[model samples]
Target: MTSNPPKNPLHSARLSFRAPESPSDDDFFSAMVSDIDAYMNSNITNATVPGSKQAKKYQEYLTEKTLLGVVICLRSTHVDGNESEKPTPIGAMHLCKSGDGMTHHRSTEIGIEILDGFQGKGYGSEALTWILEWAFRRLGLHRVQVRAFGWNVRAIELYKRLGFTEEGRWRDALWHDGQFWDDVQLSMLEDDWKQRAERNLDR
Candidate 1:
């Protein structure tokens, strides 16, 4: 019988982040689209249906413009230790410049989406840690920001716990589920990230 190869090494305790080779990772992108809830669709992107033209277009745009785009994968180890299976892509995260010119050169916006099955598993936090390190240290960015619906308490809490601070809020900006929700803006400065790193080292 043929034996399988070992698992991919670019992984944390249970999650991995791999670069998207092209916009054609249809399976990965479709999985994310299928798992996004209505509220998330409203706040993140309007393309909800998998394999739709809009979704494909957006995927292409993201891959083409992304400074960094990663496919979030789940790793599994074999019992016998003979071989491990390849990680399965469960979601994605992207970091892109906010705009052109020197004024926006030091700022980037981040976006992330994880499938329903992988939620609440610390995978998002792990991915964020890796992305933030790349953003501040590798890419030499000064500011990183994300937007979330006020009703997305889970995401807001995660961002706060990771040292992001609320920068602003747009009142009743998003209309979803027959009600309006605030659009909350949160950001972390390079200095703040440095302080966080120092604190972690001390701990």
Candidate 2:
């Protein structure tokens, strides 16, 4: 069985977390389809169709998970107690504690896709840090892993900054843009995270 960690004080960052559920199918489909397109076009250098079969498959997975859960929308931090700024929800991160086969354990593989406009500016880092803390402290996960091509230096740095260590690297795993690029695998355990957290606390 999977367990969530007790809420930690470090997670008091002023941000809102919304479970994956849109008001209507049309909204979900439109938003997700665009997200999938952005992910494919930006991440996969050699991606074909603007939307691929894999995109559809992931969409189907989200739609069929009415009982398990829906995709979450991570909103940005709100400024003063004034008018509420509408969130763009440019990026998405998936979480699942119950799964069949290899992933059925106290671990989760995070796949993040930020929209074209929100590629940088620390949003990815904030969202990932929040999610990892929730996974380790709130969900009591043993470990969390993320994979990205070596070319994605920004993401690599973000993962490392969040206490993730390089666990593996698949040399020349993907051939794109007329050259082969290596895939880097990064991971962080609960203990490792705590150590990092403590060190940061002391600093």
Query: Which candidate's lDDT is highest?
Result: 1
lDDT of 2 by residue, 1-203 (tens): 97975754432343344444434434543555556445543355445443445555555555564222233343445475332564344555655445666454688767666665666667667677777777888778888888888767777888898778999899998776577778899998989988887898999
Q: What's the lDDT for all of these models?
A: 0.77, 0.62
Clashes of 1: 0
In model 1, residue pairs whose N, Cα or C atoms come closer than 3 Å (at least 3 residues apart or on different chains), thus clashing, are none
User: Which window of 10 residues has the lowest lDDT sum in candidate 2?
Assistant: 65-74
| Candidate 1 TM-score, true structure as reference | 0.84
User: Which runs of model 2 end up more than 4 angstroms from their true locations?
Assistant: 1-15, 22-46, 52-56, 63-85, 96-105
Q: For residues 67-126, could you state the per-residue lDDT of candidate 1 as single tens digits?
A: 887788887778764228877777788897555565455888888877777788898898
TM-score of 2: 0.72
